[model samples]
Target chain A: MANTQVDQNQVLPEYGPVTPADIRRAAWRHNLTLQWSWNYERMQALGFMWSILPILQRISRTKEELIANMQRHMNFYNTNPAVGSPIIFGAACALEEKGQGEVADSLKIALMGPFAGIGDTIQAILLRPIVAVLAASLAMEGSWAGPLIMFLFGLAWFALKFPQVTWGYKQGVNLVTTVAGGALDKVTEAATIMGLIVVGGFIPSIMARVTTPIKYVREVTVDGQLTEKVVELQPALDSILPYMIPIVIVGFAYWLLKARRQSPIKALLWLTVLAFACSYLGIL
Target chain B: MTYGIGIALLLGIIAYVAVVMNLGASCFWHEALIVGAVTGLIVGNVELGLMIGATLTLMSLGMWTYGGATIPDFMTGAILGTAFGALPGVGVEGGLAIAVPAALLMTQLDVLGRAITTLFIHGADKAVAEGNVRAVTWWHLLGQLPWGLTRFFPVFLAIWLGAEPVQNFINWMPEHIMKAMRVTGAVLPALGFALLLTMMPLKKYWPFALLGYILFAYLNVPMIGIALTAVAVGILYINLKEVRARG
Candidate 1:
C-alpha cells in the first residue's frame, strides 16, 4: 500500500489489525483523564490502565490476555501528563498490537523516567511559569485578559495531547531519539534563562509596597538659626538600592528554603510573624 | 455578589473536579490565577479575585506536585480567599491572612484525599483480578469523589457557614492588627519568589536575575520590557555557547 505520491513523513506506520477508530478512542481517554485517579501507591497507574483499556480490550483475544494487559499497565507509573504519558502509551499501544506485551512493559518502565524529566522541565517548570506569570501580572491589574490568556494557554496544551499521542504511535520507539536530542536541551536552557529574568523583575515590582514607614526628625543649625529637617527611611533605603528591602526579604526567604532546608510552610509562617512584629514595632 | 450561594457551590465543585481529573491539561485549573478569577466571577468581583489569584499564583510558583508529593492546596485557598476577600470589609489583605495559612493546612487534607483514593486504586486492582472491566472503570472514576470532596467541603462550608464568622472576625480586629495583615500580604510574595529561586539554578544565572532587577528597579522598565530584554540576552548567550562549542 505504499503510494509514491504520498510523503513518507506523513504516512503512519500500519498499526497491525487495530482500526483507526480504536486509537482515537484511546487517545480521547488519555487526553481526558490521565491523572484522575492519581494515588500515593501507584501514582497514575489506574488512570494509565484505564486510558489504554480500549486498546487492551481490542487487541486481546482471550479474557486472560485482557486481564494480564490490564494488570501490567496498573503497575506503578507516573510522568508529565502532557508529553510523557502520550508517548509511552503510543509506543505501548504499537507494541501491544504486535503481541509484544513484555517489550511494551519494559518500554513503559524505561521511558517514564526520562520522559518525565523532559516533559516536566518543558511543560511544568518552563512554559508554565512564563505563561502563568504573564497571566498573573495581567490578573493583578484587574484585566479580563488575565483569565482569558491563561485559559487559552491551557487549551493549547490540552489540544497538543492528541497529536502528540498520535505522533508517538506513528514513530513508536523512534520518537525517543528525536526528543532526547540537543535541540530540546537548547530550548530548555533558553526557557530557564527567560524564567529567571522574569522572576527577577517580579521581585521588585510585586513587593514594591514592603517598605519602611519610619521617619526621623533632626535639628540643624543653619546660619545661626535652628532649622528642622525630616528624613524618611524608605527614601534613604531607596537611594542605596531601589528595592533593598525586597531584595533582603527574598534573599532571606531563599536562604530559609534552600540552605536551611526548611519547608515552605515554615518559611511562609516565619515571614508572616516577622511582618507582624515589624508592623507592631513600627520597624516595617 | 453576582452569583448566589448555589451557583458558587456548583462552580467550586466543578473547579475541583476539573483540576483533579486533569480534564484539559495537567494542573490547568489548579493554578491560583484561574481559580481566583473563577471564584471572583462567582462572587461578582472578578477584579478582586484576579488580584488575590495573582498574589497566590506567585506563592504557588515552583511548588509543583512532582513525583506525587503533595504541595499546599492554594487552588482551594484561592477560592475561599477570593470569596472572603469579596466580603464587605475583608478585602485583599484579609484574604491573604486566611489564604496563606489555609493553603498550608490544606496540605494535610491533600494527603488525606490521596490516601482515601488509594483505597479506590486497591479496588481497581481487585476488579482487575476478577476480570471485571466495568468494575475497574467504576473504581477508577470513583477516586474522583475524594479529590473533589476535599475541595468542595471547604469551599462550600466557607461560602455557606464561614462568611458571617469571617466578616465578624475582620470587624473585631484592631487597627494595628489590620495594618499588620496588610504588611504581611505585601511581603508574602517575596516568599513565593524565594521558593521559586530555590527551584531555579540561581547561582549560574545570578547575573541575568540582577540584570532583570536593575532594569526594572533602576531603569523603571516594565515587566514586558524586562521579559523582552531577557529573551535577547538568552539568545545572545546561547549563540555564544554554540560558537564556543564549535571552536
Candidate 2:
C-alpha cells in the first residue's frame, strides 16, 4: 500500500532484507555480551550469532537451517569488538541471503584477524592511552576537565560503533577494504609509534619517582677554615637525568617482562614487594 | 563515612548499572575517571573521586584483556576506592592503596564470573535447538547476573559492611607506611607501561618512545604536547606509508 508506483523492473536481489530495525537489533546483540561472555572455546561466536538471530529469523527457510546457521556461527570466533565484528557481520548478513553460506562463514573468520589488529592498535593501544592519560593528568591536577574530556572522546568513539557495521554492509568488502583495507597495516604501524611515544612520556610523570632525603651533611674544610656543606643526592641525579631512577625501573621491568618472559602478574607482585622493601630501607 | 539508607542503596544501584555497561562493548562506565566520578558523587566529594580515579587510571593505563586473558578488575577497585577514599581522613592515597589489592583480587572474580556465563551460553544453545528465541534472549541476559554481582557485592560490602573496618585500618596505618604506599603507587604505573611495551613491542618505534621520554623527562613538555607530537608523527607516517603502498 505504501509503494509509490515502484518500478516493476527494479529486480531487487534475493538477499535477506536488512531493515533499520534489523541493524539496530543486531547492533544491540553484538554489544550485549562484548566483554561479558568471552570464553576460551568460542571467543565471540555465541554473541556474534546472537546479534544476527533476528535476521536469521527473517531469512532462514526452516528450523534446521536456522539451527545450522547458528551452530556454524558458534564456531571459534573473535575480533576487536569496536569496529571489526559489525563490518564483517553486516557482510555476512548480506551474503547469507544470497545463498553464499560458506563464503559468508569464511569471510567472517578471515576479516576478524586484520580488523582485530586495526581495532587494537587504533583504540586499545593508541586512543585509550592518549585520552585516559590526558584525563588522568588533569584529574591529578584536580581539574574537572579530566573525566569530562575522557568521557567526550569515549562517547565519540562509541558513536562510530553502529556506523561501522552499516557502512560495511552498504559498501561490501571490495570498496570497504579498498578504502581502509590497505590503510590497516599503515594505521597499525603509525598507531604503534604513537603508543610508544605516549607510554614513554607517561613513565616519568606518573609511573616512577625514586627520591631520597638523605643530604650529605659532612663537615668540610675550605681555605683552611672549617665549614659544613650539604649536597642532596636527588638534585644531583636529576641534573644528570631527570627521573632517571624511574627510567631505570621501567627498563628493569621491561627486561623482566620481555627478555625473561616473566608473567605480568608475577612482575607486578615483585614490584609491590620491591616498593615496600625499598621504602622500608630508603633505597628508592 | 556514613550514608543514609536510601543513599546507600542508591549508590549500590548506580554501581550496579555502571558495570552493566561493561557487558556491552562501550567501556565508558568502567573507565577509572567515570567510576571515580560516580562514587565521588555518591559520597559528595567529586575531588576525591577524580583523584582516586586518576590514580587508578594511571595504574591501569596499560591494561587490556586480550584473548580473554584475565587482568586486574580496576572498575570495581575504582568504585571501592572512591567510596572508601571519600571518608574523612581516609584520603585518596590511602583508599588507592586499599583499591590496589581489591582490583587484583577481583580479577579472579571476573574470570569466575565469565566462566559462570558459560552456563548461560549453554542455555542459549539449548534454547536455539528448541526454537525458543525468547529463551535465548533471557539466557543471554541471565549471564549478566554473575557479571553484575561481581561488581555489586564488592560495592555493597564497601558501603554497607566494609566502611568502618576500612576506615579504621586507614586511620591506624603509620605515616611511614603511608609514605611507602605512596612510593609504591608512584611506581605501579611502571608495570602497566612494561605490559604495554610487551604487548606492542618497541620494535622500530623504540626511538619514538625514547623521544617521548626525553620530551617529558628532560624538556618538561606536558602530556598533551607529547600527544600532539605523536599525532603529527602518526599522520606523517600514515601518509608516507599510504604513498608507498600506492607505489
lDDT of 1 by residue, A201-258 (tens): 7678767877999999999999999999998999899999898998998899889978
What fraction of the correct interface contacts does each predicted structure contain? Answer: 0.62, 0.59
Candidate 1 lDDT over B54-155, as tens digits, reads 999887778776555567878888888888788888899998888887787676567666656756776887789887999999887777788888777766
**Any runs in candidate 2 off by more than 4 Å, and if so which?**
A1-16, A31-36, A171-284, B1-5, B25-27, B163-247
Query: What are the models' TM-scores?
Result: 0.60, 0.60
lDDT of 2 by residue, A1-284 (tens): 12335454442232246577876777777755654555433446667777777777666555555667666565546667876777887777665554455556646644554466567667777899999998899998888889889888867777777777777666554533454545545545665677667667766765434576667787899999999899888898889988888887778777888988875556766776887888888776
> By DockQ thresholds, what CAPRI class is model 1?
acceptable
* Candidate 2 lDDT score at position B226: 80
lDDT of 2 by residue, B1-247 (tens): 4655665576667766776675575656678788788778878889898988888888887787653456787777887788777778888788898788878767655655664564566566677777676787677666668778767766676677666664575468576665665566556556645654665556866898888889888888866678678778878878886789799
The per-model lDDT (C-alpha) reads 0.74, 0.69
| Cα RMSD, each candidate | 14.3, 13.4
Colliding residue pairs in candidate 1: none
Please tell me the TM-score of chain B in candidate 1 relative to the true structure's chain B. 0.62
